[model samples]
Target: MSSQFTVEKTQHPKTKPDQQNLGFGKHFTDHMFLMNYTAGEGWHDARIVPYAPLSLDPAAMVFHYGQAVFEGLKAYKTEGGRVLLFRPDQNLERLNISNERLSIPQIDEALVLEGIKELVRTDADWIPTAEGTSLYIRPFIIATDAALGVHPSPQYLLIVILSPVGAYYPEGLKPVKINVESEYVRAVRGGTGVAKTAGNYAASLRAQEEAEKQGYAQVLWLDGVEKKYIEEVGSMNVFFKINGEVVTPALNGSILSGVTRRSIIQILQDKEIPVVERRISIEELYEASVNGTLEEAFGTGTAAVISPIGELNWEDKQITINKGEIGQVSQELYDTLTGIQNGKVKDTFGWTFEV
Candidate 1:
């Protein structure tokens, strides 16, 4: 594990973009944290250097076999000029989970957390102050072994980059349409679905692109095995409120254990809301929609926090959720989560980490 890290400031800093239109992951901060892992030695040579394109060997295993793992979190700037992070330890812990699944070496979570704090402090100016805006943190590891093969790589490189981003969607908190994807499967039960790996996302691009072309925001994925049970959305975890109960898909080793999803469940429990994590089938969901029991639906993730689902097109049958508007539960969850994030509300859950 690397404890001490070197900081190298950039001499030619790029101009910061307009906070109003920063968009999501479009602009990066001036500096990025990088570390290396060797076969004999553990993680070492941690440094924060100028943000630039990486120069890797063309035969790097990551280019060939896609042995990469990544995690996403955020840093918020409060109105009182203070910085806060939301459930960063959970994110770092999940980083190791992905690493274990991807055959990449596990990272020291505490060390990485400290590195993240230092990196955030180094680029403090890049933290956006606009409404519903914050600094996005991306930590990733790639197999850098020059010799490519099907086996694990001997060397790896870990990088942590910061981005000044607004809301993940143009509609912001507005509910968006979701397409129920029955054609392509995201991951099987015994596959790399739970891991935050690149291939999993690459497998989703086609479905997402088609959904977007059809005027939808994203695709709600089904379980790969049955293709009838709801798994998750393309980018976020899906939740449904039906018959006065909150329901989300139970983690079946094929769905990502989302930090936001966990937080939302905890929040619901704290408020004594009936929350259930189980296998929800599309047929059951559609039946509830027809029976007028489906009350609300939303997707949770680090980038979007809470994205209400206004409409769902499954097998060419569309249903408008909560009259195509964000429901009471969705609104409350968004407000509570964002308030804690931006220091607007009291954080009783101890989720916010002040920086």
Candidate 2:
């Protein structure tokens, strides 16, 4: 795993964006890290080069077979001039899981982590300093084989890029309206849903677009088989506070295992709050709303630490959560998570990795 990395600085550096209006994934830093994987050579030629368009063969396997995987995390610049990463190890572990599922060669976890740290340090100035702003890190692998056969690619390319991003949603922490999607299913049991691959997201674009058209922020996906049980939100894991108990869907191989979701569960358990991970049906959620037991709802992910779900529209029926405002539980969780990330509060869970 010990490999020498060559660094090449960009000749024409771009101007940094305004921190206040730094939208997500719109702009990338000057340099990116890349490594290649071949059948017998394994992974080699690790280097940091100027960010630019990639020249790939048109017959690359990724275009046809969709053998690719990616992971998203962030680097934060604290008020005290310190840089930090939140639960990066977990993200890499999950990336390997995705690689295994996609039949892509496994990455050296430690080496890749070192590459990420080096890349972040190399572009330290790119980390945003404004409130709710951070450097979004995207690490991905793609099959680069030229042949069109339906087998695993013998070649691959791993790339890590950095983007200075603002809030994931333009509304920031404001509560959002979600539409329960019953028509199109995102994933099914024994499928690629659990993997953070391109195909899974490609399958969701239609549903997400329809949800957006209906004046909703995101789609609340249901299980594919029954279309009755709740799975996850379009881009995050969902949680509902029902009758003082917080419930989220159990990991049943069809939902992405989110790092933020795991952290929130741990945080709740540490505080001794009633948290349960089990299958919850959409009908049960609607019934809880009718009985006035659905206290609050929120979605957890890396992009939006916690997105408070204020309203849900399901089959022409609308249910308002917490009077269409941010609830106390959601607020506390958001504050604690963001505070730990930005160095405003003590990180008791040892989740922050200081770079």
Candidate 3:
């Protein structure tokens, strides 16, 4: 039950880069939002075209069976020009739990949140009011049948792009380092690692390009059957803080349930601050960093909403946390979740959604 949509606008409009060097997802946003799906006529034509290039049919079953599913959210503007959207209905209920773990069909989370509020109100001037900048939405799905050996994929598409960003780790809040890998792994218990598919990040790009050639800014995944618990950190969702509480890692079906990791565990349980999920061991976070309580370490999603894990290399041993600094509860949970996502904090947990 979803139809009505169209908007063509954009007779070429490019030049928009330099919100003090945007970074993160390079650039993009001139209008985009598509929708198709065809198995006895289901999700029809919806459009908002003009952001080009996407011919797909080189035997497109997501280019040979990797079905695909995606999501990531953001779009804050509010210096008064209003454009909020932080919990986009929890990213379309986690993209239909990654399209039912990649079998791929189902998606109408209220017609994709009204096609993400009319494509962010028709690209609301491409968002970005500087400060830390944002407007990176994404939302994807693909499995376009066009002949492939894959068993599913009757045909599908679903786009939704827009990008305009900054700091998805070039060390914006500093503190990163990580690398506790212990020989790859990342996802077990019936796999597809809690489903944000696309071959679970194409199987972690050869251990994040060998932990970025030894400089380390990613790779903390452990537990594809006891590589000794831990789970994720580079693609976000880690968190430590031992003794004074706050621990994370317990959505086990192999992690990846992060809408900024449940809004940093509901803002550390609404500031009572004892947050605890369960099972977290790299020898219990290196014995709480050798009995100093381990203090603070962080990582959450929607692209670095709170990175902060200042050093931890393992197996050859190295540690450092809080002293490598960024704590104070990861700068007050990134200033109260970027101040309740750019409205300068006062959504009172309704979790924003203006557009």
Model 3 C-alpha lDDT per residue in residues 1-355, reported as the tens digit of each score = 1246878878988878888779888898888888999999988887888899999879888887888888889988888888888988988998898898788788888877887789888878878797878888888988888885758888898998989897565446888788888887867878788888878888888998999899997899988776888988867888888888988989878898888888889988988999989898898788888888999998888867998888889979998888888889888998899888988878788989886
Q: What is the C-alpha RMSD, rounded to one decimal, of candidate 3?
A: 16.0
Candidate 3 stretches greater than 4 Å from native: 1-32, 35-46, 49-66, 77-79, 84-118, 123-138, 146-148, 151-156, 161-221, 233-236, 239-281, 284-286, 297-299, 303-327, 331-333, 340-355
lDDT of 1 at 49: 93
Clashing pairs in model 2, backbone N/Cα/C closer than 3 A: none
Residues 1-355, candidate 2: write the lDDT tens digits. 2246888888998899888898889999999999999999999988888999999999999999999999999999999999999999999999999999999999998788888888898899999988889999999999999998899999999999999999776666799999999899999989999999999999999999998998999999999999999999987999999999999999999999999999999989988889999999999999999999999999999999899999999998998998998989889999888899889989999999998
Candidate 1 accuracy as TM-score: 0.98
Judge candidate 3 against the unseen true structure and give its global Cα lDDT, from 0 to 1: 0.85
Model 1 clashing residue pairs (backbone) = none
Candidate 3 backbone collisions, by pair: none
Whichever of 2 and 3 has more TM-score, that candidate is 2
Q: How far is candidate 1 from the true structure (C-alpha RMSD, Å)?
A: 1.5
TM-score each candidate.
Answer: 0.98, 0.98, 0.38
- Model 1, position 117: C-alpha lDDT score: 91
